[model samples]
Target: MSSYSNDNTTMETTTTREDRLGYNNNTLKIVVGAFITSVAWICLLFTLIVFFAIFKSGQLKKDTINMLATLYCWTTAIYEDSYT
Candidate 1:
């Protein structure tokens, strides 16, 4: 029989306290990356929706376009018009 000694315990880079909840450094990185990618996709979808909505409406006036642009910037996390 082989003898095991806990005194010589070597630390595992992966087996950490954070890994208990699957939120280690690597896990956090992956989650953040996925979130950023999803956000980008959502932003693209919103852009396409707004574009189609604005162009498809032949009755869109100057005021309507301005309103749409303002709303788009706001919803897209852009700064207020006063800051621009």
Candidate 2:
């Protein structure tokens, strides 16, 4: 009984040591999952930034158009007075 118990202990210790020495399947899976999630988050952030940039560009165009119209109206009024 003592010898049998000793053999079991030795086998357990050896298996534990071997398994602890390197990356296991579970560890690899976790690492891959983390990397993929990080990439996805980065892509999401990039998409949000692009959306914000496009929105700001559109607002700037609208402001520019409004300014040009105002300038055109003032210039037309001035020319009309000068002609009269």
Candidate 3:
């Protein structure tokens, strides 16, 4: 047998435990997250619909296409500049 020395080893814990002094740890995060996400999406959709209603019939489509084109051009310019 060998000597039981405590000089070359640590004296720390080897297990993990959660502490709940006065709170609940079993929360419905998934359900709440899904609910918040769905609400955000619905709000965004309604905002888009209201925006379209405010503008002309096809104005929103035209504006979105124009913005997308501008974004594409900007990305391409940046990419070309990076290669130089």
Which numbered prediction scores highest in lDDT against the true structure? 1
Best by TM-score: 2
lDDT of 3 by residue, 1-84 (tens): 233438797465433244334334444554565566565556556555666674656556777757645655654554444333
Better model by TM-score: candidate 1 vs candidate 2 = 2
Clashes of each: 0, 0, 0
By TM-score rank, best first, the candidates go: 2, 1, 3
- Worst 10-residue lDDT window, candidate 2: 1-10
- For residues 1-84, write the lDDT of model 1, one tens digit per residue: 234457787544435566566565676666666676566557657766877787897767888778767766654553222122
> What's the TM for model 1?
0.46
How well does each candidate superpose onto the true structure, as a TM-score?
A: 0.46, 0.49, 0.36
Error of 3 at 6 (Å): 31
Tell me the deviation in Å of residue 22 in model 3.
Answer: 25
Model 1 stretches astray by more than 4 angstroms: 1-23, 59-84
The CA lDDT at 18 in model 2 is: 41
lDDT of 3: 0.54
Task: State residue 82's C-alpha deviation in candidate 3, in Å.
Answer: 36
Least well predicted 10-residue stretch by lDDT in candidate 3: 14-23
